[model samples]
Target chain A: MNNQKIAVIDHKCANLHSVIKALEIFKIDVKICTSKTELKDIDGIILPGVGSFDPAMKNLIKQDLVDSIKNLTFSGTPLLGICLGMQLLMENSEEGSLNGIGLINGTAKMIESNEEDIKIPHMGWNNIEINDNNNSRILNGIKNNDYFYFVHSYKCIPTNNSEVAAFTKYGQKICAVIEKNNVFATQFHPEKSGIVGLKIYQNFLSFIEIGK
Target chain B: MIINKGNILLTKRIIPCLDIDKGRVVKGTSFLSLKDAGDPRELSNFYNNQGADELVFLDITASSEHRNIILDVVEKVSSEVFIPLTVGGGIRNLDDIRNLLNSGADKVSINTSAIENPDIIRKSSEEFGSQCIVVAIDAKRNNNSWSVFTHGGRVLTELDAIEWAEKVNSLGAGELLITSMDEDGQQKGYDIDLLKSIQKKVNIPIIASGGAGNLKHMLEALTIGKSDAVLAASIFHYGKYSIKEVKDYLNSENVPIRLI
Candidate 1:
């Protein structure tokens, strides 16, 4: 396979350094693309976001990166979203009044805090159960019932049932992962999930390599 | 006190708190006569490899070393260990939180600052999300109840422990790290009463800190005390009990935990 570069889109509202550090362990070329001009000559794109929804979306728009990101993913450039970045791939969010990139037909809804005796942020190591039929490429070697680090209040609800790649039971059956063609995302912070989390970044880079 | 939420059980966390002074991991008896334990990066990597759920770095000398030194430590530890890292001590403003997060810290815990200016908690949570903000409360038994203590548990405050837990939770603190001054360094066990009291009032996750002698105390904190996670320093620092030993004991007690 030829050499590949992954663009980690920096919208100025995320813990981008951790994500970059995680990806760097795989020995793959990774760059933090801050503007649309920097999106050129990249095999894959990673949208890692934190903070609130409205401000993150506003930062993306202000940097003129929304259109380029949408185009890149629409053209089948493998894109991976982490945490709030995963939430922004949907149509809208309950966290704030802002339209998402509309890459997937879903809405990022708040995890019902009153449903059970669970924490709001769901901050801990919760295991994931993958759907065997649609084994996501990003989860190539990862086993079922493996734990990943999660710190989020909202989950993505894909309008299409087939988009669900994995399920993690928090207060209820929360959507943990989504995979639609070249677009993949995880609600958990694989960067902060230890050695198992680092395997995820490695797998994604290999996936991009194979696709290239 | 273990609430099983269905077939899926949330793994109980075992956190090792490192009291860093001048970039070196230090643990003292009652926070005095500090002695070097190990290098921050080396010890952090060891704990991460030993299956520590998360790591907490409290800069005991933050006021003196200030930003650059601790930021460098945080940067090194975060790069070496991939698990969630929580940095505490000397975080006074939003920029402190921003800089720590930018330096690769997963979360920042504020104790004295949060008590002095509660707006800092709200503003930090507002700017960087509650998931990355943790409030540390140092409490000491005051007659029938516990009072909040500040400045390395030197000065006493009028704020009630239970009330402060509720207040910070309302202000958008995702987690609470409550350390018991009376139980700290006793090595008998955690302050069960303090943990039970605060756990009853807050819906957010409570990390029970101080007073861990052995694996059984850690288990008791999780079982009888009903803490979401257990934080200890000397036991792990002085080579008394390894993180794996405590986790193995908790697992044997039927507490669901992620085995490394």
Candidate 2:
């Protein structure tokens, strides 16, 4: 596991320090990839994002990484997206006018609540209800309902229901975790979610090892 | 544990605030008369281990000359601690917000600057997502109403507390950290009336700050005050109660808190 290299893509829209720090806790080799050249020979790729959708997509295009990342996944390299990174995996978002990476068939929509008590940003710790049939390796030891830290205004809506691994309720049944072939993403910040969140990173690493 | 029951139940956060001055954590009464607490990194680690949902570090003396000192503290603590960290004090513009966020601060709280230039909240939030911009409002009782204070509570503004809460929310602040000057350091309890009024107007989460002397005070801040989170310094910094003790108390009362 120590010899395996994991590349975290830097699109100028996120603070990659925490993600790198989280991955380093397991003694794994982590690198920040800005362009396609830095992504060569990587065992796994992590796309961590913050900020808006259009700017995130624009940053990927500005770095000339869109094609490289898309091609890398086509070759069966495992990819994991976090927060805005998860939304970038969808086809597009209502927050902005840019097209997403199209890795998953879905659209990102604004989370609205008619009740005044329910906030819009949906910030704080909330538990997830794992899909009973979800045997995804990324959720290996995670329980059915465990709290994880979340801070976002938009929720991902994958077109295929089977692709969703977990869901959390706010005003509606928002997708919290999604697992498709060679791709896994979470709408919450696992790096800031504490021990249970650390378990998620551990499970992702173990999945990478098995793929090798 | 809060049963899902097909509903999203977000646990009310119990946060330990560390007021940093000259690179050391300090606590004070009504934003004056400071006393040393401990090292920022040590206390942050202590809180994280005790299952604190989040942490807030306010640089009480956030002068231009001492800016780098707080950045250094944020860098060191964020490297070791995993939970969300919010750093406030002397945040003047977008560059200040960017610098803190780049240094690993999950959120940046601005009070004086936001009052000085209300546009900063909108600009900063637009540049770096609303989830990272937290507006800290210092309120003092003015007869039957509350007036907003800035500059460590030394300067008072003409803006009304309740109205300012709604204005900041419209300006794109992700959360509000409201510190009541009247009840701060008094140890009786949070200013329930102040929190209740602000919580009613804003859609963003409100963190009740100041005047937390015991566990029940913290509970009142969450339940009656309707704050999404509670921020206390003296109680936690002085060892009056550990975070676990408070969580255990709130848990028994069924407040839906995160218990490790």
Candidate 3:
């Protein structure tokens, strides 16, 4: 089946089911590529993640796929990250002493509230206010303040606010979506999200608009 | 408390319980091969515009790393749909309920959190009012007893879901989002037995979830299952039956429903 190949980067510790399911709901072609060997010449790459930052980074390193991912991103190949995938695009993650992919300079830290009563995991559905004034193709099908499903405790705080394409509130203000050229990341899962999340994939598919 | 957006209460709510990961909705058969159901924002717009009464967004993603719903996504959808959205999964405390409501969610549902900290229900109800607190209980038949599963049906808790429903009601929960894990996605129909049992035990409105394939199932849920409302993902997600179609069928079947 030679479909539009979208890889749920098999970086050892990743949630491939929901991402693959989202692509399937859109009827787009998707595959689970656990290794760089299977990700040659793909239409686009979807790097998804869950769980801890240190273990996730360790798994990515153990598989020796980080360099390939960087190469792919540098080559201008379209790539997207969800949740931990989004955090990996940052410069460093304070959750674990590991530096991130550094694709975008940002810091990911725990959700802290001076209110003295906010929970840590900050679970549940919340509204995502779109920030990209340019309204790039990724946000084409979505509108400002459309709620998407989110599940994360720590979130990336982009130092460069310009790179913040979207933002969400969790105790303190946190980065929701980050975009710079071919690289884009959403702290929320478009795959597991409802129709709004599907629109993100549809937009991404349209955003790439080309096969590798 | 009084209601406005949720006041008239939807008679035929085309509610979709989204299975979210990362932050998107995921639907699958038997909890596998999850597909892009659609963007939550776009889908919410379509549903809200499509004459839907309400929306239910479930953060189906496991919170092993303490994941929370993306507020931007919620704000975006709430701003567009202008409809009440009931959000659930990994809700731990009253603060979570406050955050969700502040982020534009109309109602917040609790599962394992209620079990781990039952006091939260009382606290949340007192702070946010019972109307804003929804208790979602996932029960599966086990050796002649129904058991509640938490953490996205990954962990089977010791609490008897049916009894827990009554307990939560006593704890001041306003509603119940009860699902039969055995019937979820099977499409045979809503779990009549499960709903019937819980309906007898709990006084609050019960939104029966799982095992709905067609309108007949919905009618059965209302007439026989005696559910206050019926919720399904597959039948509605695949577009096999539009919300209007289901309502029409339900009406024909003599089930009282809010018709446009």
Candidate 4:
């Protein structure tokens, strides 16, 4: 069926350069899917995004692809959601009145600062502290304090603590990477993160080499 | 002459403007042509290593009424490269400015607030020092003079671009990133006349942007416009040229730059 190994859910968000470029670096082939009609034969998936929850989820609904995502996770495909994509992994979001894919039981909340109120849509690069026991092959060659790019004000606070794989602080310990069994997601853009980020794509490539 | 590969600070930086929307690198082709480009961390790192000199990630989109993509873009890039990073958009008071600086950015650029509240220039300079705070002015030529545009070039403010440049200089802005909105993404060439006007107005290092099409465009921005630096987008993002090649041309022509 000419099934590509990776599928990047387009969903009308910009910045696929990071994901596409990273996958290219690792020699991993990726197929873009802004709709459900295109994701059927993909071996593994990467939901890369940047934008609001409501509109993004709306796009997903518009394409009627939410169920397909849920079904794919159950079928044991490795799925990784980046940044806003990570927020979409949750059940609901406060940013724009919308419900996420509900892959993980959590609510996306704003990071509160003790200072004279921190400017959000928290901009700039910071450190990520990995904190999970997930043995998923996606993180096989990963390390701690490996910096990844971030650009969001809201984060997914997993209702199920076991869902979190990593986190970074912006006046709060927000969820960074969430892995629930075969479905995994990261709030950071590994594509834009240089070397360490390259390793992530490499690992993902090896994890979902399209066998299952 | 395109020698240094990823020396973003050197090659007349061809920064791809990332207007972060909902935590993604929203590609606004004509300034509002919003399209998702994947993740910021991956894109910024790729651009940095791929030969983009510094990156400007604007958070507020000209108004504070929407979402911010600062922490997300920052946390991703700094971990990826050792390149210089400048963040702007929706920066209001001094606190917002300082927070960005402390977050691993080499500099912070301010626009709307600088015009709305002139005090911001002085206060940010006093605390973070002039070099850390970059005053970003987005302008469009109006009638006989150059007029400043605020909020992503959506509003035409009463401030004159050159006059604001001079005042921004006096307020201790370490550098000035002046974007010519009328010429942005046109890829014809730089706004030499406008840059020349500002060059005569302010002494701070200027990053001339808008209409950088080819090597000659960058050369014109530096030699004719007398701008200290040049910035562009399409040429780099589309792989038309490399930063190393641009800097090589500049250095070959005796234009001093940070060669790595």
Candidate 5:
């Protein structure tokens, strides 16, 4: 864990400093990778993002990081996406026109409540309901319904139910954490979720340790 | 610390606002003379340790000499305090929001500028996201209803308080930070009617600001006033009540609160 480096890819749509600061708190060796060349020599990768999907994808294309991320994930590098980054792990999103990385068999859809009372962004602290049989190492040692900070309007709907590592309810049950093979993602901001968020980061570090 | 049960997201936030003048955290009486509270970094760390849900850093110095100092404080606080941070004061344009966000602020609040040009609310929220765009409303009771005030509650705007809140929410403002000018620094309690009026109009989270004298006042803001969170300065700054004490009080009353 000490020697292994985790690259937090900067697609120019994220508050990368907060993620860096969160990683730094646990003494995790982390770097900000803006391009393909910078992605080299990293054991693990964290794709963190904010804002709309179109602009996020545009920035990734502009920085020539689209293929680099795909290649690294294809090569079995442990990849973790946070918030909009997690939404990008799907094939498509209703929030934007451009297609996502298509790493998972899913599409991101808007979170609409049956009742008019539910808010749009689903902002604030929400708990996670872990999938019992997904075998998600990302949620290892975590409780069944531990709360994490979330702020997003769209949610990913996986084609295969097995990919759902965790689900959280806003208006309906939305995919909160998805895990498939080497790739893992969360729809919550672990960096902003306080102690439990740090614990989530620590669990990610443990994955790096197991790989090493 | 988040404790969630079922569909009810039961966590009422307690945010400690650090009013920064120049570089040091300062507090003023009726928005007049100021006195130092402590170093921003040290005070933030203390609050974070005491289980504060979030922190707000307001650059109280209305001058150009100390422009970049708050950014440094925000950067320092963001690194040490692992909670959501909202930065406000003198935020006028997209570049200002970008700079603050780049410096590690989770949210950037716009007050005077948002009222002057409401388009900035749409533009900034589109540029960033609704989650990070906070519109701070300083309202004073004007006859029948509250009126919007700008320039640190000095300049009064013709815009009605309730109308302004609805307008901003429609224009992509994620959250509303409503500060009652009448109740500010009075320490009696939050303007319950003011909070309730805005909360009814907008679906977004409302952070009740201004007066907060005791634990019961905060409870009223969360309960009767229906505010999502409560923001305060003097009560926490002068050691009248610790963050832990407040949380304990709220928790005892069955007001879903996160205790660290």
Candidate 6:
């Protein structure tokens, strides 16, 4: 596990420092990758992002990393997306005009609530209910209805419900975690979610270990 | 388990604020008369361990010479603490926001700069996501209404508190950290009227700060005040209450608190 290298895609969004710091606690080698060459022979890939959809996609396109990510995932490299990174896995998003990475069958839509109490950004700690039948590896030790920190305005809606590993209720059933083949994504920042969130990274590392 | 009748519960946050002076954490009464608290990294780690939803570090150093001191503190603290960290005080432009974010701060709060150049809010939010840009408004009640203050509440601006909140919301700020000057350090309670007025004007989450002396005050700010989060300093800094104790109190009150 110490020798296994994990590449964190830096799309010039907000700081990728926390994500890297979180992974480092597991004693695995982590590298910040901006171009295709940096993705070579990596054991795992982490797509962490913050900010708008169009500019993030544009940053990936400018670095010519769109196809590299798709091809890597096509070959079954475990890829995990966080927040906007999760939204980018969908075909498109209503927040912007650009197309997504198209790794999953879904779209990112704005979370609207008629109830005055429910906020738009959903910025706080919220509990999640794991999909009983999905048997997601990332949520292996995570219990049902455990709280995790979240900060976002948009929610990911997967076309296939089976792909959703977990869901959290805000105003409606919002997709909190998705697992499809080699790709896994979460709508919350695990790095900032404290201990339970660290357990998630631990599970992801175990998944990578099994793959090896 | 505040609303456990088959309803989704997004718990309200309880943030511990540390006002940094020089390098150590400090607390002041209504933004004056500073007193030393503890080390930033140690206190931050303690709060994170005690189940603080988030932490805010306000650099209260008066001189420009010690401005870089907070950045070093942020860098050291962010490496150890995993929860979301927000740093405010002396942020001037996008570069300052970028510098703090790069130094591992999850959010950067701008007060005086946002007033000096309102466009800074829009530009910084556009450059970085609105989620990472927090606009801190220090407001003081003036007779029938409230006015926004800047420079650690030492300078007054003609901007109406509610109007400024609406403007910042439109300008793309993700959250507003409103500190009440009148109730600050008084330990009576938060400015409930001030929070309610701003909450009505903007859809963004508001963090109520100042005048947190007891548990009921914190509950009142979250319930009657309608704030998404409550930021307190002296109570926690002086060891009057623990974050767990406050959360337990709120949880017992059915406030949907996150209990670790």
- Please give each candidate's TM-score: 0.96, 0.96, 0.53, 0.52, 0.95, 0.97
Q: Write one digit per residue (lDDT tens) for candidate 6, span A1-212.
A: 78889999999974698898899889999989999888898988999988888899999998899999999999989999999999999999999999999999989999987888777778889999999878898998898988998988899999999999999988788899999888999999999999899888888888889999
Q: How would you encode candidate 3's per-residue C-alpha lDDT over B154-203 as one tens digit per residue?
A: 78988987889999999988778988888887888777888888888866
Global fold similarity of model 5 (TM-score): 0.95
Put down candidate 5 lDDT per residue, B1-260, tens digits, no spaces. Answer: 12233346537889999999898999886687788899999999899889898999988777887888888988988888778999999987999899899899999889999988899999999888899999999999988799999999899989999999999999999999999999888899999999988888998999999999999999999988988899999999999999999999988887777766
Clashing pairs in 2: none
Looking at model 6, the pairs that clash are: none
Residue B11 of model 2, lDDT score: 89
True contacts kept of 3: 0.00
* Candidate 2 CAPRI grade: medium
* RMSD in Å for model 6: 1.7
How accurate locally, in lDDT, is each candidate? 0.87, 0.90, 0.73, 0.71, 0.88, 0.90
Instruction: Supply the global lDDT for candidate 6.
Output: 0.90
Model 2: what is its DockQ?
0.77
lDDT of residue B132 for candidate 5: 94
Q: Answer with 1 or 6, whichever has the higher lDDT.
A: 6
lDDT of 1 by residue, A35-63 (tens): 99999999999999887788889889888
CA RMSD, predictions in order: 1.6, 2.0, 14.0, 14.2, 2.5, 1.7
The deviation in Å at residue B48 for candidate 3 is 1.4
- After superposing candidate 3 on the true structure, give the runs of residues whose Cα lies further than 4 Å from its correct spot: A1-212, B1-12, B63-69
